[model samples]
Target: MSLRAIATFDVSTGGGVGHGLATWFGAALAGPLRGRLEQEQQGTAFFSASTRATERSPRQEYQPLATGWEAMRQELLHEPETAHVLYMREHLGKPLVHVRSSTIRVRRPNAEAQLLFGADCGSLDDVAFCAGAVEFLVAALDTVNPAFAWLGADAPASEETNLDWVLGRRVRDSVREARKLLRGYSWTTVCPEELSVRLGGPGALAATGAFHRVVPLSAGGCDPAGDRDRGGVHRRGRARCLRGPAPRPAARCPAVRPGPPGAALLPRGRVPLPRVTDRKREGARHADATARAVFSG
Candidate 1:
């Protein structure tokens, strides 16, 4: 089964933390992840596009481009080795923060090569690995630079919410939805850099013999990368482009902290992330129940 889900965050102006931290975090985690990437011949990567490239690819097939993100799904399918981290040229430009630890595997009969997310397509180890990468990246980034409050760095009142936390919220939501669709699968835990506590779930694991794709938050089209710059460094102070609803004041919600060992990171307390089914809103109910139980018990 092909299971996919997306969790999107509306980054406020100047919400993007500087690229310097991303670079530093990427390098620090690269060495530990190198062993895994070496084993698979490809570790992990991040991808984004420029406003100019995104403008041209709106109608393209197999690859879609929205002003928010430039999809490289097709290119990734063709060049798995090309995976690398990317920061958008415009910090407030609605960036696509994609991370994957996937590899090329041959399909049967035609023996066609394809790339799928989640290491080994859903093994316990695969789940652990994917989770580990996300955990490390989120922790490193959030601690180093939380997402800036709405309206950029100069906003007089700083919002308690950061980019990493918001991004993690989206990821946790998506994983909850996917898990509902993919229950009874094997599970594993990976905490390479003690970041899993920050990400919520350990990782989504693919079951044995299960052929699947882990499409995290992505644009709607498919074509691959073209003769465009893969990633670009942008200067701050660009015009603002708000796509989603305005973020509420952080004061409205309590701050989220790093969750405990083997627990999902939520503002309230420890609870496992859920898979969202048509009945999944019940999952939210259940999550609330569980949180209540934890507190009340």
Candidate 2:
């Protein structure tokens, strides 16, 4: 089995699930995951849908967001139950990394948005990237303001059950390394079932100052043991909260190339570009992308 990590959020409030997804995507591309996704020359974003067969043949569905990021954002902002967005990095016609988001439906009362890594075509191994992604999601709690969120391998099951199916040595090592780097953070959980119960419902959890706030476990910092006793949750690690306003695209960011006529305007505030200062750094980034491709392959 391959290594996997999931971050689930209760995005039923605020702007609903679609808006939450848009916010999360923008933050991800503009923040920690920028180096991996923006620098690549070949990338594609698409919506997946199932088709029904008619008496004659199967009918095709016209997807507006299939064009690019600008269109995708527009749909996500307006649609209530939009198709999940899948992003892929391509090299020589082969896929390197695949990032996917959860789909929100109209009838679902309490919709949730989930960001998955290494669950589809790839296995997450970059410790730095994994840690950065987790940090970004935790910080995003303020803007997206999901009632409850947690990050860890698989779903909110017992640790033993979650890791029981692991058969490969490499996969095991990846899981262990991810835990080591992510432990001590309040949202990082080995078993989400226990945390959810302790935290109570979404309203109660949000009132605990855990959402939209970064509570680290350091000297004089928030205490997990004490928090647990007081009907709260805290881990034994230190992480800085991404304070202040949302980040804007730097001047050095790549200019949005003009698409064909009638194309939607790309949102400047959310666009993310690689910031390469020197040749050595560029080479290193490329090497990292290659390593990801190798691992996924």
Candidate 3:
């Protein structure tokens, strides 16, 4: 049977302790996660579910998920990879305090691919940090990503799920109401980074190549070297033309034309990045039509 893949990422970094410390301040067990990214390939995970799922147990103690993201972010520091460690330190601002949770959907790979929800905290600096972070991320992932996680990151089943345990109380309430419609055991560890996760299988390998081609416009006046890397920078700032009345000196619109590899300028303004796949197509279709109608009316 086909399964819908859901992964949530949590990127929250504020305090190093609190009821949250069980998750956040928990230091990572000393030692690197062993193995480089390409060498490790992936973490060890079992792909089979031995326990048959049924209704969630009543009186099932519920753990408080302040942001739902904290649980996952901490886990990222643990386990393999010098590159990931360096990558986190480099971009996330060393001693990264930021937390981000994301989920990526890997479709039935034309090749071999599986959806796995993951969490990593950029704040982790020690072993205690790893201890807490691991359990939390594992909890969120096992609960949401059906393709990965047999337990832990997930609780067997709860009343369905929540994408955010914080900043999403309304959604959580609505989730409770929606529970009446779902059959089978509803896993409820709470998927937090639902929005930032990827969704596609090996089908997305195409995306890796294509994403590079999408080239972000240098609107913020990027460095000259950055321009060289991003392919010659395009005009910065907003545009008022493109299809409007006419070109006037007051019109801040810059022209767009085809150029050589390093100089190709896409239609000057903020080009709405194109949805190159079906998953992207779905995301593009989610605009608030009712709100749009009201605004237009």
Candidate 4:
């Protein structure tokens, strides 16, 4: 119930499973900080082809310029098997929080986690980019392969194919289980594609997204000293994120500080500036009153 947002992503050509999983994790991250509530309930999401598996999955493995991303886009125009997910948004009916992961490895038995998404520092794409994305609902799940060769059956019956559907139903039934573990709630359903043809709901991990980064709230920010040159344009306004080429202030603002209230007002329309604590304002008022009293005498 509290997870008003969700995101799901996957590498386009290879590592589709990992790509799929990251989006859900990312969306869970960006939901609660409390910004303006989005007018539409969800946002678009994107999935990059896994660079990790690019070399392995013939479709996308190529030079950086060749396999970097452009080639991945053109390929999506043709088939579903490609790892990148560009169609999920318009088709799936949910918002997506697009993301990429570099240097990912499945560490098992003992368990250690680090920043799993970026390739390294100093790259824009090295940070999270939810846009420049074709969006969709990403409903992903890992369930016990329902069709596990039934020991007694000769040719696995159509019932075997229906295992995934049963899993989806399980997900719906155990939706609260995920909520309790995560300490937040959202509707969950098992919906798998391409793995098996039978239709039964499977238990799943689900989330939502759109027009967002869906990154962790505790995410480490990008560099700052790199952005100090832009001058006064942003200082007078709201804060700019230093993650990239944004402006920085504190050369100090030029607005002149007004003198005391008792000070004679110049013909120009300037109100006395309020002091931080108000003691100055009171002192200025008292002096102004004294000056007026002497002038009258």
TM-scores of the candidates are 0.23, 0.40, 0.18, 0.18
Model 4 alpha-carbon drift over 4 Å, by segment: 1-58, 65-67, 82-297
Tens-place lDDT digits, model 3, residues 1-297: 111112211122112111122221122111222222222223221111111111242221111222222432343233101001121223223322222111111111100111222234322223343333334434323222221111112221122222111112232332332212111111111112221122222223124332211111111100001111111212331112111111222213222222112221212112111111222322233321110000000
RMSD of candidate 3 to the truth, in angstroms, is 19.4
Point out the worst 10-residue segment of candidate 1 by lDDT.
Answer: 237-246
Error in Å for residue 116 of model 2: 2.4
Q: Write the per-residue lDDT of candidate 4 for residues 108-215, one digit (tens) a residue.
A: 111101112211112222112211110111211121111011011011111111211211222222221221111111111111232111211111100111101211
Task: Return the lDDT, model 2, position 245.
Answer: 12
Candidate 1 clashes: the total is 16
Cα lDDT of all candidates, in order?
0.22, 0.33, 0.20, 0.20
Write down the TM-score for model 3: 0.18
Candidate 1: deviation at residue 24, Å?
Answer: 9.8
Candidate 2 lDDT at 96 equals: 27
The candidate that wins on TM-score is 2
Residue 74, candidate 1: alpha-carbon lDDT: 36
Considering lDDT, which of the candidate structures 1 and 2 is the better prediction for this target?
2
Supply the global lDDT for candidate 1: 0.22
Roughly what TM-score does model 4 have, to 2 decimal places? 0.18
Comparing 2 with 3 on TM-score, the higher-scoring candidate is 2
Query: Model 2 over residues 27-60: C-alpha lDDT tens digits?
Result: 6555544554334433443233222222244533
